[model samples]
Target: MAVMTETEPPPPPPIRGRTLYRLRVLRHDPTALLGLVLVVVLAYLVVAPLVAVLSDAFRLQYGDEAHAGQAPGEWTGYYLWRVFRSPVSRLLFWEPLLNTLVVAAGTTLFALVLGGGMAWLVTRTDVPGRRWLAGALVVPYMLPSWTFSLAWLSLFKNERAGGQVGFLEAQGVRTPDWLAYGALPIIVTLGLHYYPFVLLLVGNALRRIDAQLEDSARILGAPRRTVVRRIVVPLMLPALSSAVLLVIGRVLGTFGTPYVLGLPADYRVLSTGLFQSIRDRSTGVASVLATVIVIIGVLVVFMDMRLMREHRRFVTVGGKGAMDRLGRLRRLRRPAFALALLVFVVSVLVPVLTLLLSTITRTPLDLSTFTLDYWLAERLPGAVGFPHGVLRGHELWEAAWNSLRVVGLASVVCAVAGLLVGYVVVRGTAPRVAGFLRQVSFLPYLVPGIAFAAASLSLFAVARGPVPALYGTTFLLILVMAVTHLPYSSRSGIAAMTQLGREPEEAAQVAGASWWQRMRRIIFPIQKGALVTGIVLPFVSGLKELSIVVMLATTGTQLLTTLSIGLVDYGYTQLANAVVLMIALLSFTMTTLTQRLTRTSLASGIGG
Candidate 1:
């Protein structure tokens, strides 16, 4: 072969102008640019409202300022002093704070015990009816967590006339305040509903655990208790801690259950206190309460982070050799089955049966009082506003349709935005932009729902740039629902994307495929299951979301949640129960339909 001359390549083109260079970079690094844009938009939507609320904490609000002889726009600590230092602070803040802690801790412990036990029974033992128990245990979570409290009220509400007095009181049974209201009811109701969080987490961990580790421990002559203490507990801590964190966060923000259960006894959590302050137009006090809640939520997050950091060395199921060996419960299997079934009955069956029965009966437990007026009667002269039966009336149907439309649009938007966020955070090159986007997207989760609602009202009640005044608009509800529920979809997208190998996209990129083209043809198709889940979860959740919708929905923009709350407010107990039952049924139907259509488990989407 003839030797070739060693020639250097020609010199590169001269450097371009800054603007053109940036344009070129935008074209090439589309994901990075997209991530930057997402950060800005999310900051405007999430961070800006939160900042406005925080500022309200230090600023003089109208009512407080008026009372304090200060100008409306002036800054004052009058509200802060009243909340923390004044004599009334004990009644206004400290007592509520103590009650909140008690309820939260009690709910967490109850959920953990019940859920952890069920997880063990389902994942480890050869219990009869394991398949049925696995599903039935999670059914309560599909219902609004406060559905339990509502059912509890239907069965146990006492000391009030009319519909507020429960079936027990109507039957001349004296239901004690301790059982009928306050911390006990709140804990039990919230526990029954929230236990599924723990169940999913712990069950997933148990299922993924390597049986070989336990076997090795047994082979070394370690006792079962010793094996569990030394090996299993450490392995399961992540799931346990995750379950605890979720429960804690939920309790901090959960308004409905406590509000429904605690109201009779004048019990108040921070969420209800904030809601009350808002209702009374105590903007300064509301702001202070909201600030305290956010600070608590942040503290919880930091504690969770520190706990996770300490457990960094304890990774479970690293390779392919994991074997989920079922334990031989033998004679105890039937007992375990009974125990699991009992929990399902107590948590899911009871509340649902109560709601269903209450809806069908004019009065609870009196067969003679059974009537179809609530469901299908064309006219009920005794009824107010909704003088027709629920099914025959315009209100329920309209509200249901509104719920479906608004939540559907929101879910779709949430899914698409979630995908974009995941793409940027996982696939983009700009680490800081990705980090900011992730944090901002999740910021809404920490903020109390009512606080966010109050913030949304404050921020969007007026025209801002291209966004018009949205306070009484359905678009506002859709926007808030999409943003508030975005965490579910975004987390789902991130989880799916993290597992996805980038080789397909890299190959497409080498073939001169555009970013959108790759995302459309490859990423979207690959993660469609996750996208569907992202959409469905939010839809189901937003359907029964009372706090946010209650604060936002007006007469013309009534959603199912708002409609149900209205019925409750009007003392239409049967009508409200019927509406709540419809909500539960719809949520269950949607979840089942999604699973049937996509062949993906909702639990897998959450736990994965």
Candidate 2:
């Protein structure tokens, strides 16, 4: 009362909308505005398609007149019931679901064990040939998943599958049915191919941890095993969880591995089932299946987020510290080295060698029947029933050209957009807009590639406003691949920017340089290595990506991966193997060149 008597009646509290209006006026930030725009655009892109797919699932299609007993587009649980409760559900849903779970679980266990062990040996132990092992470990992940599947099939395909005799049979080994095509081979091949993801993630974490913490534990009388169990394992949980989630998400949505290995035995997982449904013109049921896959993907992502949030409690020492050199195994060193070498050979070298051998073989399993006919002949006598040799195939050349164009475009777009998004998020003062952009950019990472492809097809099939139908276009493929890979490049950008402090920019500003001048002359020059990494990693990934393009690509837009899949469908294994090898070689060369360029630039800059 006394204060009110002296003061002009307290200024009226701002109105709700007025407060927001004032806030916007005060935050005249270009980055924030750009981030808001990006977030909204991404959300619309991701969500609208999903909405369409869900709607399509519920509504009757033009050809659904056969299901006349059910009301068209009316609220009905018919699709779900038919897939989940009917007698046929056992074959369509339940059996495949069980098989999928088993394969997924087995793959996870194998990858974790193999990748984790190798990561530890390379990062923590005084292991011999550590550098060689480290580089070799990443090769499997770089190659296409189906490359491994084809290799496995080339070596293991039995008479049961109607293929030319496999390597085992050629050696007079009666390969068991399980080894040829089914759950067992599928799990093993996929696990070996995907384990490198775990190795990269976990090994990076292990390398970054301070050695002083373990030394301190030892000095406190903690035994090596105890210390490892209590300290190392706890510290690694975040990275481990990240790897696990990634593998699970990848395996769950994978179409190539199962198709190559499982389809021969009539083994069907959700992805295979969905593909069949679409192929059979059962669009409603396929959409429903895609929706289910999306739900599962969302749930896994939620769990991953929860694990990351709780990871902070496991922190050990934080400051810069030395890496401990584990004691040499001495007598065990040779055996350990041999074991690691053997694993590398089995996992990477053998499969690739097998593929190369198969590409030149006249027939699948008859090495004695070897021929350059598949590669050098203008036509393979039409016995293999293909129009041209692998070398001269017009279709193969066209697919390769298409792959390069699409992947190259996608990489450029993703890199630029990701860098912009990263700058906005890390530099902007508007927390809400920044956070929204960052999270939305990451949304595509959490969705299964197949499901995302399906959703994109639904969204772009029809025109919305000025955006015309992008269906069956290379532009559409480029857009989807770019958006799908945005998360990785965005992360690269954020890391790059964070490592590059604002002091240099501030110095330029103080000296009267404009923002554009500072960015062009100073910031970009220093950050070019990271920029290249951001661009090239996505390029490599997009080049090999299969699932994201599977549903969207038509004959006009067929990418190399899709072409390989088509060849498999047509039962042209040798030609398909040749294409797969070409794709793998291209990806490997690009990745190696990019990394070397980045490192050389960084080294030269540091020296200067």
Among all candidates shown, the one with the greatest TM-score? 1
lDDT (0 to 1) per candidate:
0.83, 0.80
TM-score of each: 0.90, 0.87
lDDT of 1 at 593: 86
Candidate 1 per-residue C-alpha lDDT over 1-608 given as tens digits, one digit per residue, 9 for 90 to 100: 99989999988655676678878767755887788788888988888877877777778876565567788877887888989999889878999899989988999999999999998888787888776777778888899777898789889988652455788887999999999989999999999989999998888878878888888889999999999999999988877987898788788888888777787678998888888887788878888888888888877877777777976677655443444568889999888888888898899888888888887787774668888877988887678677877898588888998999999999999999998898888988878988887888888877767768877776787787887888889899988989998887888888888999989998998898877788889999999988888888888888878878777898999988778777766777778888889999999999888778778664562222
Regions of candidate 1 where Cα sits further than 4 Å from its true position: 1-33, 161-164, 211-228, 316-323, 464-467, 495-523, 602-608
Report the C-alpha lDDT of model 2 over 197-244, residue by residue, as the tens digit.
788888877876777888899999999999899888888989999889
Q: Which ten residues in a row have the lowest lDDT in candidate 1?
A: 599-608
Q: How good is model 1 by TM-score? A: 0.90
